[model samples]
Target: MSFGLFQREQRSLFGEILDWMLTPLLLLWPLSLALTWFVAQGIASKPFDRALEFNLQALTQFVVGQNGQVSFNLNAQARDLLRADDSDLVYYQVLDSRSQLISGEPDFPPPRDFETPEPGRVLLRDDLVRGDEVRVAYTWLARPDPERLVLMQVAETKGKRSTLAAEIIKGVMVPQFVILPLAVLLVWLALVRGIRPLNELEQRIRARKPDDLSPIEESAIPQEVAPLVSSINDLLARLTASLTTQRRFLADAAHQLKTPLAGLRMQAELAQRETDPVEIRGSLQQIARSSARATHTVNQLLALARAETTGRTLPSARIDLARLVRGVVQESVPRALEHGIDLGFEGPDHMPDDCLMDGNPILLQEMVRNLVDNAINYSGRGGVVTARVLLDPFSGVQILQVEDNGPGIPENEREFVLQPFYRALGTNVDGSGLGLAIVQEIAQQHGATVLMEDAHTDRSQRGLRAAVRFMPKTPRQE
Candidate 1:
């Protein structure tokens, strides 16, 4: 099967260069030939025409009127002068004003009336004479005797004229034929020299390790190629970041899985040796809780992976922010009730008029769930976890704020907490620590901004507050 242009095997850089260089050169050859032929014909015909006019003038001088009668005369030297070359036979004729031949061949026809013939006009015409093709020149002559007007005609065979024209054409075209190929060769060489850097770049990429996501060096790259290299470097930087995140996730999963498996083993041993039924039941219960936490951690890790890979084949679309927030709160309410934490959605019943954003709904929901779940897990029983979506009129920003009355993070440690697998100190809660990182990634994908701050009420006590601000779709009216 034949491949399309894009899928075809790549041509050598040199070959591609040669094709472009030679194409125009080849195309111009025919044009050059045509132009050369035109110029050659003009050059050959001009002198011939001048020679015929000179012969006509010489014959005019020989005309004399004696006793009121016209006659023609020619000298031996003039005849010899006219027969200068032996390349082709020459013929001449003179006719009187009565359209009758006065001298030379009787079969020669009189000159036709030219549309705009001027005095002393000399023009070339083609004719068949004695079964041979000839080039002819004609001119009108005037004598002092009013009734003695004469027309002088000169003719030569085509062989001599054609030979002269061929010689001129060859001289002009032969040099160009040689020079054009040389120019094409030079152009091919220059193109090869120009494309060397691209080949070097390809070689550099091929030599790298599969896991090497380092940026390509831009110092030696040509200015024309710098943008392409910069784009590749940007992609490499993102891939490096992704690989680093994956490594951290793997390490965190191993650490998190080890603790639960060990606890389960210990619980099983205790249950096997227990004497009282209540003690055995308590050990089994502890094992079940540890198992549940382990399962939950596994599920979160899977969810994070899905969130990362989602939207690869799908495009973001307009999502209703208020509805998405409510849905997330509703799903997490059962968990919130288990801890007796108050989970409520505080936003417009319907999305505020004209409040919409381009986003992937599933990922957005995951982002909201992670933020609210973190608040619920951190806050104590009877603590208020308020999920608020507000559209600010002045700034034209849509804000989703989840504020919990739990001990807030220290200011210095807030930024560090966003790193994958980073857990706050002294928190006994079970989590993979990927919640905030996932929140940050999802927010970034939607072009939103995430900020963490201390929600202080009494100017002394600090509470946790995480806000994701979505930039407004349109400017607010005055």
Candidate 2:
């Protein structure tokens, strides 16, 4: 039962709109023709019907009463005049109350429901005369006696009415054949003009330079297409931000690598020049230190790059934050002992289901490792570093914190410390300043926030406390 009027895998907007507009007009044209033909027939038959009624009235005058009997006396001139018609043959009948034909054709059929005839009233009907359909107009005439009457009827063949109706149909329908196509063409032109804006938009996009990320102007766009334009503009804005971030990351990485690479090159040249065995060994030691620092810087750069990439492209799963923090702390114990720093973990022995959060395990572990390593390096010998994970029962927010007995970052430089290659003043730590930046990037990916504050409120022991606050898990995540 489906018309499937607009079936297409990839439909054209112009074609869809045109089909909707023209389908109804094309369908209704035939119905319009039918109605016009019906109306034309009625219009053509009116004049002929009036003529038959006039002739019927004229024939009634010939009726007369004589000696309590009805008769019709018509002269030859009047009868000849009545019969004079170029397109149709006319027939007439005169009958008495007893159903006796007194004059004219005796074969005329009686009117339907004519048993109680109203005297002196003319009525018109269609009936068959000699097997040919004709129009009949009939009337009753009163006699001198109140109970007696005469019936007069005049009928004519339908030849004249049929010819006029055909003429009217041709006059009305012949012009429409020429006009329909022209109307469709006008509609097509209108639709083309209406959708010209979208075509212009496509051209504008194609003509733009590859580096051009500017937004399209919204003022000139139609209200109907405003949403589409707005969405494209939003995409362009995000692409610009991503490109800017990549460019900055590359420039910062190049600048940071240059320092350690230059150091390694200089130390290598000095070791090659040394002739004394003691001097050679000392230069070799310095070269080893430079090489180690270069290796560490390269590794930090790679870690930062991985954290950013994983944030954007990696999928996440449910993980227990408490267990993850404990593992990272345990693994860092050897490194802590090498620096003579005491590192410990604190959290629930068995993590509850509510403490689980959704994240990339590899990235989250890298984030914790950077935080613990940074704490141990800055805390130095005999320093205490504690890593802990705790869950807020009421709010369901998960918290991961690394507290160290290192000089806290000044309040003014706390925000800057999270940016890559930024280090606090007067700190002698030999490390790339990328740990906090990696921590921040990973935290943001998991919908968490990072806070840098003092572990101890007292001014005498102002140790640093780096805390990450994870947003409450939704029911779906649980």
Candidate 3:
């Protein structure tokens, strides 16, 4: 029952501690009792053995021998002293060297072992005689002739020693029966007090509102728990920033969509009122353009959201930079041709087969498309927009670049353009302004750097160049 009582209930820290402390104490208690009992027996038997020695010596003095024969005759007064123990029966024996009982009890047993006890010394041992446990003390008396020496022995039943040993045991162990339970009670109380703080902490957490995200107080927390509190605080700060960004994005999207939708409604009304065929056609054309712009803005907003999401959780795969850039450039070529802008890839038609790196393919493709789209949109007509995937010889880095003969962003305004919905002033391009912002966020997630510089230094035709340099990794090379 004791071995598994704790296992039947849910595990408890307190119970485990008690088991560790108390099990050894309980198992050793009986062993300690047995050892104490043996020691008590030795203590109680000391006085009795001494008394037996005295009787054996007294009986030795009564030894008499005449004519080469020996006998023991105790007078009444000395014999009464020998039988003085009230609680136990006593017996005596005297024997000649030839093993014949010369006097005292005729049936008394002699000492089983004796090597002629030295002079006046008394020897004591325990033995059973006549079906009763008894202690025996014996001494040998010397005669004029060494061959006729006599032996004297005295024996007593063990009742007095047994009683004294029981008293010693009771005296030693009774106090422990009272103190052991008190000690266990004190330990349990201390454990309960020691663990009270954790219960209070759990209660405090449960009492909080479900929507509460405030940081836990570090000052009140124990040093062991402070790191957990700090981590929770960090998570809350990030979530607050994410929520703010989401709200602002929603507002911007609503504002951007409002303008185009109103224009579409106005253009539709204009077409309904106009009777002239040319004017009606022009209004319908305006309506079509407004719808196209709205669609393009929606797609750009979706791309920006996906870019933000991917920035938080980046997924990787082996991406061939040259192949991905070529595909994105081809997709943007029709738009480039519509504006009469010369759009072409500047590097090898097929880059080195080893031009590969780890990246999220979809996000990387979106980044390239945004860069090329920005170039084609602002470069106007008769300008070249080139997309390149080149490897740097010195650094062994793979670089993706988009160069255009467009009005380059001024040095002072370069940082602002990477922010959401930020457009440089004095430019007439119609854009949702999230293109480069999306590119910057995705680039950050891939551990790449974005650099902006002039494609040409000529004052009349200084063009903007945007480049992304990937951190180098050794690729499989044949």
Candidate 4:
């Protein structure tokens, strides 16, 4: 049963601490009581033994032998001197060499024999008498008579011994009992004070405004919490940068959309005011063109916003680069024919089904479509715009290049054209200028690289070659 109890789960930290503190006090309490009893017995027994020895010695002085007859006597003065105080009851016995009682109580046991007894050598032992425990001590008395030797034994009840011992233990341990609680209280107080700074820091953070991106003041914070505060401040800085970019994008988008809308409205008013059939037809044609441009610009703006706002964490799947390129080419074919530009795709004639990359198909299509559109729009009559998708075996990259043969961007203007709302100086075509920027954003999200390089060293091609190189789904090992 005791072993089974030991296998049970014990209590937690606070319970364990309380048990540890109180266990020693409870255990040592009994030990203290026992020690008190022992010391009290020894102290109380000492004087009784001495008086008994003195009485035995005094009675031995009365010993006399008249012609081999033995007689013993004790005086009244000596008997009166042997009485004890009210707190303790003392008993004594005197025995002759033959183990016969010469005086006092005969029921007391005789002292055990020692080979060589020394003067003042006391032998003390405990015994049960009438169901009460008692302490006894005995000493030997030597007389002038050669044959007359006496043994003295003393016995006392344990009441006075227990009382004196209890008092002694209380004197020693009372302060310890008082000091232990005080020590625990001090430890609790210190812990509360030590955690105050952390509470204050939490309150300060909770009190902050939602848009407040300022760095926290670290000087006032405790050293232990400074690292946490620094991390929070770094997060705030990143959030501030993201918010600033978003606000700039919104402002630019509104400004760009306003121009096409105003042009559409003015065309509509002019058409309403015309009366001649030719002039009215001309005004209507202008309105139609303006409205078409406005609609196209709006579509491109929406695509750009989607590309910019889409999270990079959107699920990536294996995309067939050849199929994607062919689809985009088909979509742009009509637009290409309208401008008198020859548009074609060059790759494995059958379209390599395994030319794959890890990317979002919609964003990938948008990237390819914008690049091709930009090429066709820039190419002049009788110009060739080629869309090619190649899986480079050596570099482990999927490369897409859209090249045009008319009015290629100058070396100085190529970088500027990629910026939002930026248009080339000589371009007369209506455009939102967000197409290439959207393409660049999508490419960046996919870990792809875009390069605007010369199609031919002679620069006779006249139009830009925009290429996006994507990392292959399965890269070749070095």
- Largest TM-score belongs to which candidate? 1
RMSD of 1: 4.0
Error of 2 at 448 (Å): 2.1
Q: In candidate 2, what are the lDDT values of residues 150-184, reduced to their tens digit?
A: 78888899999899999998998889988999999
Q: Give the residue spans of candidate 3 off by over 4 A.
A: 1-213, 269-281, 311-314, 348-355, 473-478
- Cα lDDT computed for each candidate against the true fold: 0.80, 0.86, 0.83, 0.74
Worst 10 residues of 3 by lDDT: 1-10
Q: Which ten residues in a row are the worst by lDDT in model 1?
A: 1-10
Best first by TM-score, ranked: 1, 2, 3, 4
lDDT of 3 by residue, 101-126 (tens): 87767777766663545656688888
Q: Which stretches of candidate 2 lie over 4 Å from their true place?
A: 1-11, 59-159, 217-231, 267-313, 350-358, 473-478
Task: Estimate the lDDT of model 2.
Answer: 0.86
Off by over 4 Å in 1: 1-13, 73-87, 105-133, 146-148, 171-190, 211-223, 269-279, 309-313, 393-395, 454-456, 460-462, 474-478
Ordered by lDDT, highest first, the candidates read 2, 3, 1, 4
lDDT, residue 301, candidate 1 = 80
Q: In order, what is each prediction's RMSD in angstroms?
A: 4.0, 4.7, 6.2, 9.0
lDDT of 4 at 98: 70
For candidate 3, the clash count comes to: 0
TM-score of 3: 0.69
Question: lDDT by residue for model 4 over 1-478, one digit each (tens)?
Answer: 1122123265443345444655665577668767866776577556655655565455445555455444456577655645656775667776666777767787776555553555446666776554566677666555434455556666666666666666766776687678767876776576557767877887988898998789988988989778988999999898899899888877887888787678778877877887778887887788787778778778887887788777376678877788889989999899899999899999854334455567899989999999988888778777899999887767667788998886777779878888787888888877888889888889988888888888788855466789998876465665
Model 1 residue 160 CA deviation (Å) reads 1.0
